[model samples]
Target: MTHRYLKNVVSLELDKDKCTGCGKCTEVCPHNVFIIENGLAEIIDRDRCMECGACANNCPFEAVTVEPGVGCAAAIIKGWLTGSEPSCDCSGGDSSSCC
Candidate 1:
């Protein structure tokens, strides 16, 4: 699947100190953004992230933190053309605010 969202737009922070190498993020990410290497979760495809916040939500140790939002480039362009700022409602703090 292809998305129009800008690459590297979403803020995804991984804290190695907090990460337990549980691999939950690997299991939840639909875009294969995370991989377990040597018992640690590493981001291998950050550009493919869709800001779904599934990894952040599923992290038991709160190792993954991301600011989820709609990074659609087309929407941003449309907003610029329409004289409005495009914003996503997803806060990425929890699953309830996910897009």
Candidate 2:
């Protein structure tokens, strides 16, 4: 079997206009990906983000979204090998992993 190198890249996008200052996204994130400045969620650490999707799922106003998941290389590779579609936290209605 040929092995593929895993690259877990997570995108952190916040819709400032849609945010309602609920602070839910910042609360659910385990990797400390966001910070509140002027009552808005800011992307502080994109590299550290695990892609857990907690923020997107918890956001009440749907202001935040990600291709959510843990961003773990090994985990994603395993999922791919097993023929299961990888999951993301900000997947909207795709599926739930940690969010």
Estimated TM-score for each candidate: 0.65, 0.64
TM-score computed on alpha carbons, candidate 2: 0.64
| Top TM-score prediction, candidate number | 1
lDDT digits (tens) for residues 1-99 of candidate 2 = 633333446576889999877777778887677788898778776766666678888888889988765545555775778776654423456464343
Q: Which pairs clash (backbone N, Cα, C closer than 3 Å) in model 1? A: none
Model 2 / residue 37 / CA error / Å: 1.0
Any idea what lDDT model 2 has? Answer: 0.71
Query: Relative to the unseen true structure, what is the C-alpha lDDT of residue 86 in candidate 1, on a scale of 0 to 100?
Result: 57
Regions of candidate 2 where Cα sits further than 4 Å from its true position = 1-8, 70-82, 87-99
For model 1, what is the error of residue 13's alpha carbon versus the real structure, in angstroms, after optimal superposition?
A: 1.0
